[model samples]
Target: MLSLTDVDKVYLTENEAVQAVSSINLTVENGEFVSFIGPSGCGKTTVLSLIAGLFNPTSGKILMDNKEITGPTEKTGYMLQEDYLFPWLTIQKNIELGLIITNLYNEQTKKDAMTLLSDLGLDDKANAFPSELSGGMRQRAALVRMLAPKPSLLLLDEPFSALDYQTKLKLEDLVFSTLKQQNKTAILVTHDLSEAIAMSDRIFLFSSRPGTIYRVFDVPAEFKDKLPLEVRNDPNFHLFFQTVWKELEKVENQNSNTS
Candidate 1:
């Protein structure tokens, strides 16, 4: 339901201009999970911000459904690396914060928020403050807060990177299942090759700074219906990883040659 065409972003300083993203064209179909993977400073997050209208592009346009996105649209929800929960507010209150800000407060909104919290297994923790919850719980709460608004699109920026490996794996499954259940269209920015392959229906591999789509691949069958662990165990998993790794290497090598 989201489309970006020939998008470009440039950051200017006194001495030089840094092109963070270049000619990025992408389309996310309804209910599709698409992940953008690249090395650090490759503008993955920049792409997310552009889609969210946190910043306008230097060139080209972004559209959701058919309307051009001018600024942050209510039809989209964003989750970042940090949970960013208010320390003082309880889980329930935190989730309610979005509803209140959007003026969506009402009986139905509250009921939906509570139902989301319960589904994420945070029903009892609803009364607990952010300080009292574990990292995973906090992340789950953060996601609940974002999804409670029922936005048409979800933007996730390394949402699982802060957790330990085991927790990350579990949360990946949790997030994957949750999104599938909610039937939400999502675009995820991540550096982890395995994580991207495990959760995404399609993966976009981006080049380094002045990021552009270097390659795109449809995830294999092993990952289509299986858990993250199962996907990792598949023999072709390493092959796919190596393939993406080499594509990234080519970008670095080409940049070096030009420099």
Candidate 2:
């Protein structure tokens, strides 16, 4: 449902222009879960910003459902590394903020939002402040807030990075099931290879800066029906992980040599 064609992003400094990404062409089908992984400074986040319409590409175009994305649209939701919840607002209000901002705040929407909050096991925490919740709970609340607006596309930028390993794994399972249940299309940017392998239907490996698609790895068919945590226990999990890890190592080595 989303595609980027020959996209290029260049930042102009006083002295010279630096290209952040080059010749990026990719498509994400409706309800597909894709992950983008690469070495640091490879512009994964830049591509995300372009898709979110936070910045315009220097060339080419990005389309969602065949319509060009020129600016931010309510149909897309972005969940970042940090929860970014307003400390003063209670959980219920924070989750409804998006709906309120979009002028979609009404009894039904509010109820639906509350229902989602409850589904994520945050029902009792609705009256709590951000500072009162643990990091994992806060992130789960963030997910509720993001989903409350009912966005068709989700852009997750290292949303689990800061959490402990156990929390991260648990959140991964929750997000995987929730998105699948809702049939929402998602693109995740993460440095964690195993996380990418377990959670994605496909993984896009990018090259070093002035990043371009280096390789695309399709997750094994057997893993598709499993949740993120379950996928990790499959016999072939480590095999696929090793393959991606080797390729990522190559990408990093190439960057070092070039530098």
Candidate 3:
């Protein structure tokens, strides 16, 4: 339920102006999981910041549920690559932080937080500090904190990049199941093609700097119902990966030639 129309973001410097994103238009429907994929410096994270209302676009508009996003809204939740848990806070308190910030804490909030931790298989670690948990557990705990506030829209910026391959796969399933059960609208920025295909209903491919939508792919049927690992084994998985890889190569070549 988020839409961006003809969005552009430009940054000013002492010598010149840098355009990070240009003429980017995108729509994410309710209950849909969308992922943006591109090479480094493609402005994918810029788009997420704009959607989160962390900053205003230089031009165009971003709408959430038909209303313009003026500034950071409570209706949006953001999870970053790092868990960013307060080292001093226990897992239960970390989740509670969201509720506390929103001025919504109560006995029911505590109950819900515990239930979410349990669902994510972090129940045993609820009393553990961030320093005591593994990377994957910390990420899960961060996600639980983000979702605890029950925001309608979730923005994830490469939330799994730090984990090992096996942990990443398991976390992907955990995130997928959690989002489905909650019916949250999600937009994730990821470098992993397989992760995007396995997790997103639609994948948006972006060009390099001054990024714009280069291509959009609706993942094939084989991947539509499989786990991230299972999707890797699908015959067409390699085909999809090759296609996107080539598209990214084209951008690299174009940038090199222009430079």
Which model scores highest in lDDT?
2
* Cα lDDT for residue 34, candidate 1: 91
lDDT, candidate 2, 19-83, per-residue tens: 99999999999999999999989999999999999989999989999999999888999999999
Candidates sorted by TM-score, descending order? Answer: 2, 3, 1
TM-score of each: 0.95, 0.98, 0.95
Off by over 4 Å in 3: none
Q: Which wins on TM-score, candidate 2 or candidate 3?
A: 2
lDDT, candidate 3, 44-63, per-residue tens: 99999999999999999999
Clashing pairs in 2: none
Global lDDT of model 1: 0.88
Model 1 clash pairs?
none
- Compared with the true structure, model 1 gives a TM-score of 0.95
Please give the lDDT score for candidate 3: 0.89
Best-to-worst lDDT order: 2, 3, 1
Report the lDDT of model 3 for residue 9.
Answer: 95
Error of 1 at 228 (Å): 2.4
After superposition, the stretches of candidate 1 with alpha carbons farther than 4 Å from their true spots are 256-259
The clash count for each model shown is 0, 0, 0
Error of 3 at 203 (Å): 1.2
TM-score winner between 1 and 2, please give it: 2
